[model samples]
Target: MMMVFCENSFLSYFPNGHIFQPSDASGVLLFIMTGKVLLNVFLLCVRRQNLHQSFMGYFCISLALLDLVLLVTMSFISHFQNFMLLGIRFTKYHTCLLAQITAFTYGILHYPVFFVAGLDYYFTFTQPLNSAAVCRRWLYTATVAFTWISALCYVLSLPGSAIGLDVNHYNSAYNCPFYISSQTYWFSLGMLMIMCLILILCWSEIVDTVQSVKVITYESETVLFFPYDPECSPRDCAKHLLARLLICFISTWVPFVLLQMLIVLLGAQIPAFIEMNVPWLYFVNSFLIAITYWMRRRHLKVTEETLEADPFVSWKFCLVPFRCQYIDKAQKSTSKIVMC
Candidate 1:
């Protein structure tokens, strides 16, 4: 009776009743996992000095640790397949079952993790706290823990955890089935569409803004600035700067946008487990930060403190270049201005 119920649950993931052989999917998964692990390790090491200095740092370190754990678990699972473990021999079916469950859990985790990271930034900026550093650290830790626990609970509560474990049975050589999160798919699609629209709508403005922008180094940081124009009002200046920033961002992440487009056009069903990597997270992070800056553009002040928030991306360079007064002051200190 239990076997029958499990089989039915597994079959539901494939309503088409067609199970294809895994082919190179397992190899691809392993390669992706390895790359993610290496990237996370490099980031953690690079930022080790400031790993816990800010909420972003904590979030990044936590993500790195999670990626490491997943990589190790997958490696062990692959190693133990067809081997004896505590007097129990693991078959392909058992191996795929474990992989699917793990993939499902990791796949659904992206949203919650990104949400918590955003919240951390939002609260840090909006709700200025007078608490000590220790208290702040504890608060960030609790938020991170909440995201992980909530995501885990939600994944486990789903029927059969939304994984198709029967694929391996049909093809003994099949690697594993991975869950594709609809939430992630839609989120990626929405972001790509929005960026494309923004680029299209503001292409002329962006091009004009980029042409006027000058790049210079201020206090060891690259800064973008434009000469004072009598006709351009402060608001217009801000808009132009923001447009230029978007262009810069889109240029940096053009490959990611193209990949998302290709996936949509080709109807590729990339496993969420493989899609949730360091690059994807950073891409999302930059987009969220850009949105936040745009929302608060009127109130934004180009100061050294504000630029220090994001460790990975130097968004300050984009923000500081537009403030004429700031640029005037910088002109006194440096003479390395160049046109963009």
Candidate 2:
């Protein structure tokens, strides 16, 4: 009789105790979303002040706006717990469902966004946009909008929930239902594996290039220049350029890559909402840029237009040396000072 009475009391206190309570998850999401919002704002300000407006600039600004919207929505959902919206009553479960769907949508967006951004870079580098400034702006705006709209529709149309959240009414504890994104996991794993392979294959060239790389400032812009070596053939220069690019990429993304590795090894299930952030997007941006550069390496030129192509990364630095070497030796010193 005592045990039966104790069980009844427990059920009364925790009506849905068997379900994985999202109170802790909601709290963590709010904290992460707040930090991401601030980070994106700072990045936007920095890009506005120091970088030229390019396709990347537009994409980043749009992403920041999206983050702001999500942050606001999550904040309201967390605070009110339950509310009336559009004449429909929404309980905490509905809010969690909304968040889950949005998070999944955001997770799947990474690939499509990267593909479109890569296309933008390809066209910008291959056939420079000769249209008026207004036309170029419109083109970028349209591209970003299309990518987001398409991704959202595709995710929403999927058959089942990307995340599984179960709510039970019994007073028994259950496991957490955090969603670990397979798409993100595999993408990150593939990148790390490919980077490792490149490191192994080009270890010698990377070492030599690191020793030869020199930094020069021209008109307040820093350019990485490799001194011209008469004995170095065109193929050798290409190898060195690849090495330099690898170094730049690895140095900037070491922390992010390491975190991915740790998660992979431990099989940790990070919530999708928290995984999608400014740093991850920038990491993808850099990867796409590097791939584009590698493909167009033979035709690469360090021109004024190329310098303005990427808002976040100064890829011109990698190509400047090739441009500088073609000039007369007598004018090399002056050209180095003026070209970049």
Candidate 3:
């Protein structure tokens, strides 16, 4: 029974000779599945309402879903890895469909996030402060609506957008996995350009905003919106550059993407022979989301602070389990899951 279950988890293609080892073990599959499940559960708990502060909720949730897709993709890869090693004949199974879903859905899902971040920054710094965050909540909903539709169009329009092809009548794949092929590189490059443009726009806005200034005459404020140094608020902006860095990562799914580009550009010869610890990149990526979400919690404003200031809230202030974000937000805001 154990071997049968193991075979299902690691694919039953391997019989006589061992082609792969613990690298594709059932244990790893369990871990990946468990971690993704837990992360997503945590996300659902926090998705109770309009995002608490600006786009952070949307940004973080999208990222979490993307990462979950990655984990699901990993499960597919691990389950089929044995086939890659010891299958009697080279085969692609229908199970490969899941991989295609992850790549295509997650691929397009990332673009809106990039555009949203750029647009967010542009509106905040470049536009009138009074008008910032003043849009209808429906506009936010519309943005998401447009995002999914556009992503569908973009993914479907891609050359060979067919998720998988029937390799043989007995087995099939959902989509072409080697997106690095010459035919698809242009599409990938085009997306890279689009995202880069967003990044550049955000960067330019940051620079322009820093150079240009407006006079501020405020009477009394409960919480300092933007934390200020003894000298000035100008100093705080410089130090919290991580804001943009976080934004860049929010939409750009480049790390896994860049790896694929290298494999394609370098060809099978190099990839086949190269013994790389590539999974480490993804592991580190998971570690990053965990830390980023945790840190974001620390920076959230209480009832007294409304400016969205305290740019870098001390993450150490949080010893609370992340689920408590709803309770800790403030008694009036305690029902944060609905708002954020």
Using TM-score as the measure, the top candidate is: 2
RMSD of each: 4.9, 8.5, 14.7
Clashes in model 2: which pairs?
none
Q: How close is candidate 2 to the true structure, as a TM-score?
A: 0.76
lDDT of each: 0.60, 0.62, 0.36
Task: For each candidate, give its TM-score against the true structure.
Answer: 0.75, 0.76, 0.37
Candidate 2 accuracy as lDDT: 0.62
lDDT of 2 by residue, 279-338 (tens): 677777777777778888776554577655554566666666455643343333433222
- What shift in Å separates residue 60 of candidate 1 from its native position after superposition? 3.4
On the 0 to 100 scale, the lDDT of residue 336 in model 2 is 28
Cα miss at 46, model 1 (Å)? 5.4
The alpha-carbon deviation from the true structure for residue 74 of candidate 3, after best TM-score superposition, in angstroms, is: 12
Ranking by TM-score: 2, 1, 3
Stretches of candidate 3 above 4 Å error? 1-34, 43-53, 62-92, 108-112, 124-135, 164-306, 309-340
Summarize candidate 1's per-residue lDDT along 271-323 as a digit string, tens digits.
66566666677677767767767767766544554545554455666665445
Q: Which order, best to worst by lDDT?
A: 2, 1, 3
Q: Where is model 1 more than 4 Å wrong at Cα?
A: 1-21, 24-29, 43-57, 80-95, 160-175, 228-238, 299-305, 321-340
Count of backbone clashes, every candidate in sequence: 2, 0, 16
Q: In terms of TM-score, which candidate is stronger, 1 or 2?
A: 2
lDDT of 1 at 224: 57
